[model samples]
Target chain A: MEILMVVVVGVMFTIATYMVLTKSLLRVILGTVLYSHGAHLLILTMGGLGTGAAPLLSTEGPHSDPLPQALVLTAIVISFGVTAFLLVLAYRTYKQHKTDDLDQLRGSSDE
Target chain B: MSNLLILPIILPMLVGTILIFFAKNHSLQRVIAGITAVLLLILAFYLAHEVYYHPQQTMILELGNWSPPFGIVLVADMFATLMVILSSIVGMLCLFFAFKTIETERAKHYFYPFYFFLLTGVNGAFLTGDLFNLFVFFEVMLLSSYVLIVNGGTNYQLRESFKYVVINMIASAFFLVGLAYIYAVTGTLNMADLAEKVGVLEQQGVLNVIAIVFLFVFGAKGALFPLYFWLPNSYYGPPAAVSALFGGLLTKVGIYAIIRTFTLIFTHNTGFTHDIILALAGLTMFFGVLGAVSQFDFKRILSYHIISQVGYMVMGLGIYTQLALAGAIYYIAHHIIVKAALFLFAGATEKITGETSLYKMGGLLRSHPLLGWLFFISAMSLAGIPPLSGFFSKFALILSGIQEERYVIVVVSLLVGLLTLFSMMKIFMYAFWGEQKIPTEKVDKKETMGLLKPIIPLVILTIALGLSAEPIFQFSLGVADQIMDPSNYIDSVLNQD
Candidate 1:
């Protein structure tokens, strides 16, 4: 089960990285979102698959690692905020620049 | 008491919140902002003294008095205190420079809050012992920076700030994901606890993978090599004071994170992780200087040099020795002050000649003697000229590199230094020493307009730091020693009752 999860996450990360490297601004934003999801999954899988109960100690059985779960909760919130900000920035850039192909926005020397 | 740690975080935030209402009143905002900065500077100095004299101490604020793994803790160490002091120093100088430069009323109102929040994020990042909290502080800094970068809403600013915002947002997301994974594995958010937990995972490969993931996250923030493209452009959009502060403090915050993590948490895989860092440092220095050499704009050149200078600090980390890390810390201090001074000098030149591009200006030395001489001193110091703080830092770095028998990296560092000197001289010649040309409307009369005030204190600081290098180097060496031995930092937080 852990190996399957790792392979799935690895494939997702490659696709996400490829999307980010593209010239379209919107794709790049989506790519970032995808990449982050893959990374989160990879972190989870690396911790080793666990069974029994939730990390709460009140449960009498063996528990999952509560630390990674706590970390993931924070990570999810921060990433959500950043993604929302990036979406606004993307829309703003598109409205202003009138084109999303990053190549058109060349170095200063081009000016 | 631990509550003192909250003062640095809360005071600026409260003042920043209050200043937002009085945006229309520039003079009032200025007075209030000025006083707030002075207070912060004093507080930073006091904190520094406390950290220095009291080694066994830490101001660990337990959020809601929750114990250990459950709560967020802000831990103040020698490094965090030092960063706070330097940031306030930069903050005070930038605000003073802004007094004459910031003309727009809206800018005055919003600028102070963003500035304070930026510092808050910086101080918060330095102080936080929890990995997730570090990400939060980084977000706080980045969000404020986004607003500041596009503050004037210039067409150019809007265009550039968008890319800057997007790139940084992506980096922040990765940071979160990285934290999530680390937490999933370790089951604790506290940095000290994670350090203890990371060791229990005997699988070295998994550890190596996590360390590399962290490198990408911090690397994007620090502008290390391939991840550095966003920096030069975004930095160019903001006004001179904003640019200087960004140039000085923002990336250093990222580097500080890298130092904290690699030293405390990832020390187990030094051979794998540190080796990659060493190679990247060499490439970063080489390519960064090359980028500087090609840039024609005064500010653009300086922007590229920030990347190159960061390599020096990273080299210290890659070497992973006491003296080398000391040199890296010293170099960071020297570079921040000197780099900020150079950027301010660029602003001063733009004020006089009304030009940021080197092609339009000539023979500044003939009229603005102070500006020319000051720029020269900063340029020289940046190039690692002897007796200056820059030289001592580089001296220790290269010597330590050679001691470790990393001959290739040592040679590359020296060559980068020479190239750095060459590019700085290029700036000096094109902008200052060439033939003087009178402008269409008595530009010569306005040559000294608004030049002297900002550059004086900065120039004094550059030279003063050079003249009094011994004690400063000793302190840096002490910080370096502390970082090398993480037990000092780890024990303090963990042992706290």
Candidate 2:
């Protein structure tokens, strides 16, 4: 299960990297989103898969590690906020420069 | 008061959230931010004194009264408290300077709030004792900085800030990956607990990789060489006040994290890890100065210098001796004061002549002698001239390097110092010398003085730091001692009832 999860994480990271290296601003933002999701998955996988009940003393003979789930939840919230911010920023950049192509966004010649 | 540590983090968070409501009220925002900056400064000094003089030399605050190993914690050792003090100094000065210079339109867009929020992150990063908590604070700081960088939303700013945000976002992701790996190995996120557990763990090889992962994450932030390509250009996009705050405080936070982790958590394989640090420091210094040497614009030159000076501070860390770390600490104190003043002077001169390219500016020394002389003094200090803060810090770092027989870096440092002097003089000669550019009638003497006012304290601090280098270095030696032994930090956090 861990090996399969690791392979899945690697594939996700590969896709994210390809998207991030693309020229479009929106693509770059999505790439980062995908990248963060990969990290979150890696965290869960590294924490080890559990076949147990929820982490309540009364209900569980063996309990899942609550910490990685908690970490992923916090990370998801943060990534959500960051992704929203990135979208707004990309839109603003697109509006200001009239190009979402990262190459065309190079600084002015004299500056 | 053990609780005092949390106030520095909390006050800024509270004030920042409140300031968002009053962003359109310009004078009120200024007054509130000024008062808050002053209060934070006072709090910083008091806390520094308390932490410094306390026999334990480390203060631990576990949130909600949770036990340290299992719960969130804030740890302020001598090094951490000193960083808090430094950030407060830079933050306060920059806040006042921002009051004078930041456009009302920008202020109305929640500039003051984001500024305070950035401080909240910087202060929180300095004070936190949990690895994940550091990551969270890092995001807090970076989020505000993203807002600040593109606040005015110029095309240049948008382009640069996108790069900045994406790079930082990527770095933060890597930070999480490092956290996950370290936790997977040791089953702890509390830094003290990690330190204790790692000390006993036998897998030095895996731990070494985790340390490098952290170094990479922090290197991207700290402007370490090979990872510093984003800094000079991105920094050039912001207003001088924002740049001043960032140039002095932001990268240092990365270095601070590097110093904290390497000294405390990743200590078993010093030979493997610190050697990597030393090599990076050397490259960072050489390449950073080279970047500075090639830049001609006022802000651009100073922006590149930020990358270079960060190298020296890390050089102190790379050496990893008591004396070397003390020197690094002293170097940080000096660099923060001097670099902020230099960037403010860039703003002040830009205020006068309305030019950023050094070649187009001249004869400022004739019109504004005070600005010229003060800038010259700071420029000289930055170049490591005798009897200034810069010289002593470099001297101590080099002295320790020689004792350690790390001759190559010592030589590289000396060469970097020379290049630094050359570029500083390049700014002085091109910008302050030659023919008068702006007519005397167009210059607003009062406005210039207002801009220079906040910077005067920073200048005084750099000078004061120089003159008192002996006692300060002695004090920093104590800080270094506290840092070199992770046991002090681990014990304070974990043994508390």
Candidate 3:
């Protein structure tokens, strides 16, 4: 089961890296999202395959490690915030400059 | 009060949010930002003294009433406190310059908040005791930087800011992934706890891999060679004031983290890790200076120099000796002041000439002697000239390298220093000492208002640090000792409860 999960993550990561290398600004944003998902999976698998339940131990028996779960939760929120900000920035750039092609934007070298 | 720890992080955020509403009234907004910067400077100094006087202690502030591992903790030690002080000083200087530099009306409302939040994130990143919280703080800083970088939505800024945001976001993801694995292996988020746990896991080989993951994360952020492409471009998009603070404080926070984790949590794999780091440091220094020398624009040159200077700090870590670490710390302090001053000087020149290319600028020495000498002092110090702060730092590092008998690295460092001087002289000849050209007409009184005041303290700071090396070196040595021995930090936090 863990091997299968790792394979799935590997494919996701390869695709993400490919997406990130694209020229469109929107594609780069999607690439970031895919890449983070791959990372999140790598973390889960690295912590030996699970025999336990959710991290929260209310009346449940033998809880899973809550620490990684807590970490993942925070990471998700941060990624979400960044993604939203990026989306807005991409929209603003498209609105102001009317293009998402990375090549269209030549930065200042003289200044 | 222990409670004051929250203010440095919180007040700027609150004041920044308030300023957004009054953005239309630019002068009023400037007044508010001015007051906030002064208050932050005072608070930072107080915190620095507090940490210095109480060495070996961790002043942990738990959010709400939660206990360790349950709540986020801000850990203020000598190192973190020192970084906060640097950030505050940069913040004050940059905001002062912002009064004259930032002209995009659309950005006026959001700029202050993003600026404050950027500092909040930087201060938090330095102070957080938990690895996961560190990731959060990294995001806060990155998100704010993204907004500030692209705020005006100019063509140059938008294009470069996209690359900057994407690269940093990927770096943050690596941090989160690294933290997750660390937490899974150790079931602990607290840095002190991880410090103890990771040492025992090195035999498993998993720990070494995790260390590599962390190195990737921080290496990218710190602009270590090969991971530094995004910086010179993204930073070039912002105005001078924003670029100065970013040049001074942002990347150093990444170095601070690498130092903290390597010293505290990942001590088990030094033999495996430091070897790679030593090689990278050599390359980083050589390539970074080469890049700096190739640049013709004033700000672009400074941007490239930031990458080179970061190599010095990393060299201290790679050498991994007590004296070497102290040298790195002192070098960081010196670099922040000098680099910020150089950038501000560039801004001041831009203000005077309405140009950034060194080719288009000359005769500044004839017109503005004060600016010319200030730039010269900063540039020379950056080149590691003796009798200034930079020379003392590199001297200590080189001596420590010789003591360790690492002759190759020592030679590499000496060559880098000479190249650094060449570039510095190039900037001087092109911008300050050449034949006079028709100067840009001086702006009206209101436009250049309050431009030079913010930089005044930074200039004084640069000279003072040079003059007071003995005590400062002693202080950094103390910080190194504290880091090398974790018991003091561990006991202080655990005993506090």
Candidate 4:
């Protein structure tokens, strides 16, 4: 199960990297979202998937490590905030520059 | 009290949140932020005194009364408190400068709130005892900086900040991955606990890899070589006040983290890690000075100099001696003051001449001698001239380097110093000394003095830091002693005393 989770994370990271390399602003935002998800999965899988009851209630035997879950949840919320901010910034950039191609934004103000 | 550890982080957060309601009222925001800045300054000094008097005790505040290795802890030592005080001083000066300079349109967009939020993040990052908490504070700092950087929404700001955000986002992701790996091995996120665990663990291959990952994460943020391409351009886009704040505070936070982690958690394999840091420090200095030498714009030269100065601080860390670490601390404190003052001076010049490119303006010495002299003092200090903060800081670092037989880096450092002086003089000769390019009649003396007023405290502080180098160096030596031995830190956090 851990190996499968690791494989899934690797695939997600690869896809995210490819998307982030694209010139489109939306794609880049999506790429960050996907990348963060991959990281979250990696965290969970690295913590080891335990066959036990949920952490809140009293369990008969061992319980899964709830720390990574808490961490991932916090990370997910933070990334969501960042993604929303990036989308707005991208929208603003699109409106001001009249194009979404990042290549055209290369030159400094001296030009 | 252990609770005092949270004040530096909490106070700014409270003030920033309250300032949101008064966002539309510029005068009110200024008054509130001013008072808050003073209060924070006092609190910082008090905390510093506390740490100074009680050097053996590390103040730990655990949230919700949870024990270490489980609870979130805020740890305050001499080094963290010193950084807090320095940051507050810089924060106050930047606020005053922003009062006179930041446009009303930008102020209305909750600039004061974001400024305070940035401080909260910085102070929190310095104070937090857990790796995950550091990441959260970093995100807080970055999010607020994203707003502050593009506050005016200029085309240049938008263009550059997009790249800045993307790069930082990627770095933050890597930070998470690094944390994940460390947690996987150690089963704990608290830095003190991790130190203990990693010390006991024999196989350090994974730990070393995580250490490099952290190096890259912070190296990018601190503008180290190969990861510093985003800085000069992004920093160039912001208004001068914002630029000053970022230049002074942001990169230093990264360096502080590097120093903290490298000394404490990753000491298991310093032979490998510190060598890498030293090599990078050399490259960072050489390449950064090269970049500075090639720049003609006033702020751009200063921006490149930021990268170069960072190299010196990291070099101190790379050397990893008591004197060297002390020098790094002093260098950080001195660099924060002088760099911010230089940027503010650049703002003043831009205000008068309406230009930032060196060749476009000249002969400011004839009209604004006060501004010219202030710039002269700061520029000289930045270039490591005698009897200034920069000189003593560099002196200690080089002396320690020579003692350690790192002759190559010492030579590179001295050469970088010469090149630094050259670039600074380039700014001086081009912008302040040559013919009056903008015409004297157009210069407003009163307005310029108002702009120069906020810089006066920083200039005096820099001079004082140089003159009183003994006491300060002794203080930093104490801080370095604590950093080199993590037993006290871990003990205090775990309540093992």
Candidate 5:
């Protein structure tokens, strides 16, 4: 199960990299969203899968590491806020330049 | 009294939130921010004293009374306190400078709140004991900076800031990936516990890989050689006040994290890890200075120089000796003050001439001699001229480099210093020495003095830090000793009540 989860994370990261490398502004932002999801899943899988027990640390039975869940939750919220902000920024950039294509919106060319 | 450790993070956070309420009342916001800056400075100094004077020389505050390796902690060691103090000084001056210069529109857009929240993030990152907490603080800092950078909402700012945010977000995702791996390897997110465990863990290959991942995550932030593509353009988009703060304090936070993690947690594989850092440091300095030399704009040159100076700070860490680390600490202090002041000078020059390109302005020495001379002093200090803070810091770094017998980096650093001086002199000759470009009527002495008012203290500090390098170096050496021995930080953290 853990190996499958790791394979899923690999695919997510691969898709994220491809999306981020594209020229469109929206794809890049979505790519980052996907990238963060991949990271969150990796953190969870690396923490080990649940083994027929709850995640409570005080319990005696086999249990998941509660820490990664907490970490992923924090990471998810942060990435959510960041994704929202990035979308708004992209919108503003698009409005000003009249293009969602990042190449057309090239900023401050190196002299 | 250890609870006082939380003040640096919480105070600015609280004040920043309150400042949000007075978005339109600019004067009230400035007054509140001014008092907060002063108070933060005082608090930082008091905490520095407390940390240095503490018996074990580390003030540990376990949050919610949860002991370390189990819950979060805030450790105020000597190095962290020094960073807090230096940042407060820069923040106070930059905030005050923003008071006079930040446009009313920008101020109305919650600039004060963003500034303080940025400080909150910076201070929190410095003090937090948990690896995951560092990521959270980094986000807090990045989010505030994103808002601050786009405050003016120029088409250019929007365009530049989008890439900045995107790149940082991607980097942040990887930062979490690194965190996850470290947790998987050690089963602890607390830095102290990680330090203890990593030292004993015989899994050298995975540990080295994890260390490199962190270096990459932090290297991007610190504006190292290849990862610094986002810096120059993004920094150029902001107003001088924001860029000055970012130029001075923001990149240093990344360097601080690199130094802390490398020194404390990732000590087992120095041969593999530190060598890569040293090589990167040399290339970072060489290429960074070359970029500065090619730039004709005032702020652009300053921005490029920021990357190169970062190399020197990392070089100290890469050398990894008591003297070398002490020099790195001293170099960080000097670079923070000097770099911030140089950026302010760029801002002040723009205020007078209404131009940023070097070719467009000239004869500023004839028009405003004080500004010219002061900028000259800062430029010289930046180029590592004698009897200034920059020179002494470089002196210590080079001295230690030669001692370490790392001759290639030593040569690269010396060559970089020469180029730094040349580029600085180019700025002086083109902008201040030639014919007067700005009409005399346009040069407002009163306003220029207002801008320079906040910067003069930094100039005084660099000179003071230079003249009194002995005692200061001694203090930083004490810092180096405290940090170099991970046991000192680890035990005070994990074994604390």
Candidate 6:
């Protein structure tokens, strides 16, 4: 199960890297989203997955580490916030510059 | 007094959040931010005093009463409190300068809130004892900086901010990955606990990899060498006040993290890690000054200098001695004050002449002698001239370097100083000392004075810091002592007795 999860994360990261390298702004944003999801999965899998009840109950069976789950949740929320902000910023860039091509945006003011 | 450790983080957060409601009223925002900034300054000073006088006592505040290695802990040692004090001083001056300089439209867009949020993140990063908490605080600082940098949303700002945001986002992602790997190997996230665990671990192959990962994670943010390409362009886009704050405080946070982790947690292989740092320091200084020398624009040159000065601080850490660390600490303080003052001076000059290019500006000494003199003092101080804060800090770092027989870096550092002086003199000669460029009718002395007002205190503070170098260096030596021996930090956080 952990090996499968690792492969999935690897695939996601590869896709994210490819997309981020593209010039389109929206693709870059999507790439960040995908990248963060990959990171979240990596975190969970690295902690070792377990089939158990919620952390509150006292159970005889094994319980998953609650810490990585908590960490993932925080990471997810933070990334979501950042993704939203990036989208708005991209939209603003599109509105002002009228293009999303990263190459074109390379020229700073002094030019 | 442990509770005071958390106030530096909380007070700014609370003030920033509350300032959101007053977004429509610019004057009210200024009033509230000013008062909160003053309060933060006082609080930071008090924290500094408490930590300095009682050096052995590490003030640790475990949030929600959870114990160490489990709960989020804010640790205030001499170094952390000193950073807080320095940050608040910079924060206050930036706020004051912003009041007069920031566009009303930008101020209406929750500028005060974001400013304080940035402070909250900076202070939190300094104070947090957990590695994960540091990542969260870094995100907070970066997020707020994104908003602050693009406050005006001009074409240039939008473009540079897009690049800035993307680079930082990638850095943050790597930070998370690094954290996950570290936790996977060590099964811990609290820095103190991690230190204890990693100290005993023998298989350091993965540990060293993780350390390099962290160096990259922070190097991007700190603008180290090849990673610094994003800084000069992005920084030039923001308002001078915003740029000043970022230039002064932001990269230092990255340096601080490097210092904190390198000193405390990653002490296993100094041969590999510190050597890498030393080489990077050499390249960062050499290339950074080269970039500065090649730039004719005022703000861009200063921005490159930021990268150069960062090298010196990191070099001190690379030397990894008590005196070297102390010198680095002093250099950090000195750089923050002088760099921020120079940026502010740049802003004032731009306001007067309506230009930042050295070729387009001249004869400021004839029209505005006060601004010229102030710039001369700050620029001289930045170049490590004697009787200024810069000279003593550089002297100490070099003295320690020679004692360690690291002659190459010492020579590189001194050469960088010479180059730094040349570029600064270039700015002076072209921008301030030549024939009057701006028409006499267009130069408004009152407006220039308003801008110069906020810089006066920073200049005075720099001079005073220089004259009182002995006491300050002694204080930093104490800080270096505590940092060099992390057992005290570990005991205070973990044992909690």
Each candidate's DockQ: 0.39, 0.85, 0.66, 0.78, 0.88, 0.76
Model 1: DockQ vs. true structure: 0.39
- Model 3 TM-score relative to the real fold: 0.95
Badly placed stretches (over 4 Å) of model 5 are: A57-60, A108-111
- The models' CA-based lDDT, in order, is 0.82, 0.91, 0.82, 0.91, 0.92, 0.92
In order of appearance, the predictions have TM-scores of: 0.92, 0.99, 0.95, 0.98, 0.98, 0.98
What alpha-carbon RMSD in Å does predicted model 4 have with respect to the real structure?
1.2
Off by over 4 Å in 6: none
Give the per-residue lDDT digits (tens) of candidate 5, residues B354-472: 88899889999998899899999888998999898888888888999999899999999999999999999999999999898777666578888898999999999988998998999
lDDT of 4 by residue, B1-497 (tens): 37888889999999999999999999999999999999999999998888777756478788878888798989888888888998999999989999989999999988999999999999999999999999999999999999999899998888888989988988888888988899889999999999899899943788889899999999988999989999999998888888999999999999999999998899877789998999999999999999999999999999999999999999999999999999999999999999999999988888888889998889999999889998999999999998999999999999999999999999999999999999999999999997988876675778887898899999999999999999988988888899989888888787554
**Model 6 over residues A74-106: C-alpha lDDT tens digits?**
999999899889999999999999999999977
- Candidate 5 overall lDDT versus native: 0.92
Model 4 per-residue lDDT at B349: 87
Q: lDDT of model 1 at residue B276? A: 93
**How does model 1 fare in lDDT?**
0.82
lDDT of 3 by residue, B406-468 (tens): 888899999999999999999899988978774545644344335666676777777788789
Interface RMSD of 4: 0.8
Candidate 2 chain B weakest lDDT stretch, 10 residues = B436-445
- Give the TM-score, chain B only, in order for the candidates: 0.97, 0.99, 0.96, 0.98, 0.99, 0.99
Residue B288 in model 2: lDDT:
89
Q: All candidates: CA RMSD in angstroms?
A: 2.9, 1.1, 2.2, 1.2, 1.2, 1.3
Per-residue lDDT value at B105 in model 2: 91
Ranking by DockQ: 5, 2, 4, 6, 3, 1
Going through the candidates in order, the fraction of native interface contacts each one reproduces equals 0.38, 0.76, 0.76, 0.58, 0.84, 0.56
Q: Point out the higher-scoring one by TM-score: 1 or 4.
A: 4
lDDT of 1 by residue, B300-346 (tens): 99999999999999999999999999899989888889888888888
